[model samples]
Target: MPYENPAALRITSPGLCRDATFSSKHALHLLSWNIAGWSAKQKNLDLIAHLNKSDIIFVQEMWSTQNLTLDGFSITCLPATPSLPKSKGRPKGGLALLISTSTSARIKSLSSCNNIAMGVLLSYNTISFLLINVYIPPYSSRVLTDQAWEDLDRYITDLEAQSPRALLIIMGDFNARIGPNNDALFASNLWGGEVIDHYSSIYGRISKDSRINYGGICLTRLIGSRNLIMLNGLNQVDPCAEYTYISGQGSSVIDYALISQHLLKTILKFTVGNRQDSDHLPLTLSICLPERGRLTFAHNQMANPLHYTHKRTFWSPLVASNVALFLTSPSGLAIKEKITNATNPFSVLTDYDTLISKLKMSLMLPSPSHRAINRTGLPRWFDKDCLDVKRQLRQTYLHYRLQNANTLPPEYFIIKKKYKSMIVTKKRQAVHEGWKALIHASRTKNSKSFWELVSGSMRPSNLAPCHISSHT
Candidate 1:
């Protein structure tokens, strides 16, 4: 590996992305539900409002998300035309991810299939989350249903490959019952029987819809191939299976939250919650991340973690594939022309510098002249509220652990929401304060004073405690 952090290596290479314990961690609370337009009901509005506060929310079966707006969230919705015939209130289809704007979490490079799936790359300060929200309709024809799953798998696989180091989170209503603990047990009608009140992390779980269908088979295959660990039936698992969908017809744990197996340690709790005016319930996943890094937004899929050095000439990655692609790019072709037309060595050197600048811009990076700060140390903006929320969040986790509970209490979320809200406010306030200080210094016309300020900001935090390095 070129770097000490293994997660810096793309996930396509086995074991490379697995050991990223050094990467920053945060307590990420994700809620996945097939809302089915429950928010239209006045009584359910409060529940939906609370759900909207989650760090990351995946909403499926949207009847009217075309005009759907959630406060303090950035929405990425995959709209469906609702061609499927419906008789009742409204046709339901589509998927959405409401990522909280209250935090530094930023998402970009969204790709989606019409009402089927939506994929995005959500980045915190250091770690990236490749989030995919999917909804597979229960088509009358088994073939059609199977095909939907297939298309979704392809989309998910492609997205994962594109953002190899991102922690993958796939959730939403699958509408497929993947049997029980033993694939044979579903067929034989023995789900470890009554002996298995709540089996932990078992695949093909026994639910109201006990029968295994072909679509379910496809879903299980996708799960296995993707190296995902399903959180639906895991620690402290629900005794009743907490089926996500229910109706006169049946109830099943169709909605789920699946994370890459390597993220197992990060997962604190996965619990199910019910909301009024909707057939499908919500699945809440609490991940204990130790770090709350700054947020980043990307224009395209991120190539890799940025390497900070003084040299600006490393604009184009020297890898064979990158070199080949860059050489054929329009900018690369133009650079070649400049080289051929150069009248003298100095002019050639000037064009070479321009070439480097253009290449960095193409990669969505600042030119050599641009200075960017690396904030790996504790932030200066952290205030009392930030500390209090952090304390409460930790306390809540401690209480949950002491009780050996299967799910997080409501207080955890209450603290989580407050922490997110406070961070946004403090960061904005700090930026304004910083600029004011800078402006005052510059207006004084004291180069010494200005340089001193610059040097102070550039200096690394001497207070940073020593820790074991990945390198020997």
Candidate 2:
């Protein structure tokens, strides 16, 4: 049974007090991950890195934690209900969605079934869409009960009844193993009035290694009935590496992102994350929107000319080298002769704004080409040693893979264990250092630095304020 408590769901608005407007240019990048019960003690730097690249994030298995606040994204989370005895020991079956602050997408409504599933109705401009995040627990019987299917069927039916035209995106850890192998069985049971064997043969069989769990059958029936398409089917970029969950037992593609049939063409890419922060890997979906615009940032803006001028000492040698090369070129020689032979020095001088401009022109370094100040600064704890350690870890992993084709050597495991320990140590040190800096700023009452630290810690949301309500 799903959680029945209405208070289990909480709507959070991070920074914005108004709604944001989105268009075609603002492509939506969605990331889904099962964090296995995220806690404050876990290092979120890698997770934050992924969040920075995404417009919206859907997370599952998020247990109750004190640090619910994430910088720039408004979070809506639904905890497991106490009413469900199944949620006893595994209180981590919570679901949450994080929407970028800058997006114009506004939450129109929210709905949840405790730890089973959560839904958010979002609107951009006049276009509305339903985003559902779900987590179906693994059944010991390897079969989905009739009630499970009924619950899903009713929830989706209600959504369709509420807004028939709204686009639908259903994503998260379904704990379902879906592929071509079980198409015949799924189609025969749920897809009636059609030639089951013919449809199954057309879909073809998935890789032999991919298993078909009972939940997968339920998902197939749901999508087939609704004319929905799974994003996994569109993943032609890398077919073999489609699994989303891996453990000591092995790997299986259980996580998914499904969309309405009409929105299939909008999908640009679907792939899984290589980094492992949890047992389940993250899945990403990039979709082109109907509107168009570049994603701009304050840090990406061009630096002031004065700032460059003050740092001339650093670039002087490189500039001189470039100028020397230019002087020997045909175009540079022609300009030099023209300047020397010109009747009026003032006229030649007028053609060039300043010495820096002339030098820049000669160096072929336009303002746009010059490197800008890094607006997105690194975390306070991220130091050179940490970076070096990460590089070494990658190198070691690469070497191990190259040496041991398909086999895992005992030595390889030892190397991996050693590096993992070193990484954990470094991460702890960095977090400690970051907290120390924050404490110092607060104690000193340095408002600017303190707020900057706060803002930097969590990217501020750029979206307008909107309300969220969860229907149990």
Candidate 3:
């Protein structure tokens, strides 16, 4: 059992830790949901059965007319073409990458024309992860313009100049709204929340100007070139006023996840999942590493056998005996018998004003806007215990996506060995069906030719009518 290197290999130790629990050698699990426009019938199959416990999924308004396939995932679309519409509304979809089926998650497509962004690389066992899924396009000031935030900062500076040393995890729905009115000189001030949601309506003064405008830019070049680590920031997601978007009221917190500061101290748990059919609410982060095995070297005696016998360490004690049975059981033995019968280690600051007047009911910790306004009074420190060894590496990504979807080879066998003569040229399929019927008659809504329903399962219906010989 030793021949690995297909590439998603990081097997813990690039910071973003995991393993708070579960670990068939830390699999992979990344599920970003914003499947709003795919319309919520049965809340979009219970959000794809909680994104079938994820391996990689980043969907956003994915309604490119729907050629569906979310169970056992593997779809990659980023539509909004026909010259990228949106002068009226209903036409801002793009960003779909749903990989799972046993790791090796790959979905390139970057040089953004309107921004749906992608970059995943899960690979199992030997380990690997490079995740980058964005869907930035909101907060308009004209067509939510400024060349749509410089085409989302040149598709996040060309996906951090193509995975600059991997281990990323960018996450999505960046409708852009960082905290404290977003710093960095008003993090692209999202056009002051689209001019406060367009003068608080009156038919939002007949909207349009690219839909009541706004702006957002300071991702500080992927948070200073992948230094990341912000995790569920904008008021720690859903702190409850639950409004991905509503009309008769207003809401904000534009989803996010950053993380990269070497996995921000192994980020044990960073929560936010209460997705009510998408305005955006599903941001789970749980990382824990430092736990492999095998190490025994005590014979250095000034090594000289051509120097290279062994020297690796640092990976034992991942919760030493469950932290010694939670500090010796019985509720840590009644808080270590009241801190050893109160004999100072700063004895709770001498009964801290009689233990805050007998503990002001469980020492208070609920305020993320009062648990976003009382979400079942959330507490116990947001009920943590989250882990994701790539979500126990989803049975090694459903046995490598059904052995590469049934013995691989057929995702259009190299696009029919390079567009099999522009698809058997009959005047280039009648000028590609007359420019796809004039981009489906300047949409507004009705898009669904997602590369002709997933390019006929990667094509090969007796191709060879090859044309294209205009070598003049």
- TM-score per prediction, in order, is 0.53, 0.57, 0.25
Ranking by lDDT: 1, 2, 3
- Write down the worst ten-residue block by lDDT for model 1: 300-309
Candidate with more favorable, higher TM-score: 2 or 3: 2
Displacement of residue 404 (Cα, Å) in model 1 is: 16
Which tens-of-lDDT digit does each residue in 1-472 have in candidate 2? 0211122112121111122333334577889988876653134455566666887788887765222445445567776443346433434577777765445455544666635777777665546678888888786763344466668778878877887888899989888766444433454343435443322212222432345656766776676677565656332422433557655456577888778755655555676665545667788887666542322212112122111121123356777888888777776676676767778654365333223234544553322211111222333344555456555544654554455333334553454455557667866886676678789989999887777666655532223345687862
Highest TM-score against the true fold, candidate: 2
- Candidate 3 Cα outliers beyond 4 Å, as residue runs: 1-24, 29-54, 61-63, 74-91, 94-136, 139-170, 173-183, 186-263, 267-472
Separate clash counts for every candidate? 6, 19, 42
Candidate lDDT values, in order: 0.60, 0.58, 0.43
Best by lDDT: 1
